[model samples]
Target: MVTDEDKVFKALADASRRQLLDKLRKKNGLTLGELCADHAMSRQAVTKHLVLLEAANLVVTVKQGREKLHYLNPVPINEIYMCWIGQFEQKRLQALHNLKQSLKENDHEQ
Candidate 1:
């Protein structure tokens, strides 16, 4: 069982791993070699990143003949957003709106 926090932070920990996720998000179902070509890291490093992503369930791999293609599994990411950002979005927006209204009132008073 993968916890939301574990998946979210682990997936976001490494810049290179984030880049790999971005690439997969844009053009999913890419082979390991295809992903490696886009970055400067060696194949082994990319594989390590992929392992982390996979462990987090942030990525899924499929075998197509001789190649294993990787795809971004967005469910975990969305879960994180809902757990973290969704909880605060309404309050944050209300605070911003209140601040704007206060500023407007102050400007009119001046």
Candidate 2:
């Protein structure tokens, strides 16, 4: 069965989509025209990518007086991090913290 997480991963798998997400991250709310302004992709291509992003729940849209503004929704990404990546990183983070403390102690003693 295809899951919500699956959708997010699939949407993020494309470089274009990821770039679109990056653009949205830099500027939270942008209209289609604004997003398409400096892109190599055509308007139709951008629209298709936006559709995938919306399906993944990674992008959301709001209509404001005729213009549709696209915004990045970070909840799904955070959830994925917390559920998957964060758990694995906990040990590595602790190791890094320990290493930092050791380095600091060694420097102070010397």
The best candidate by lDDT is 2
| Residue ranges of candidate 1 with Cα displaced over 4 Å | 87-110
lDDT, candidate 2, 26-86, per-residue tens: 9989999999999999999999999999999999999999999999999988998798668
How well does model 1 score by local distance difference test?
0.87
Ten-residue region with minimum lDDT total, candidate 2 = 1-10
Residue 75, model 2, lDDT: 91
Q: How many backbone clashes does candidate 1 have?
A: 0
Backbone N/Cα/C clashes per model: 0, 0
Q: Write the per-residue lDDT of candidate 1 for residues 1-110, one digit (tens) a residue.
A: 66556766867888999999999988999999899995899999999989989988888999999999999988877876787678658798879999999999999999
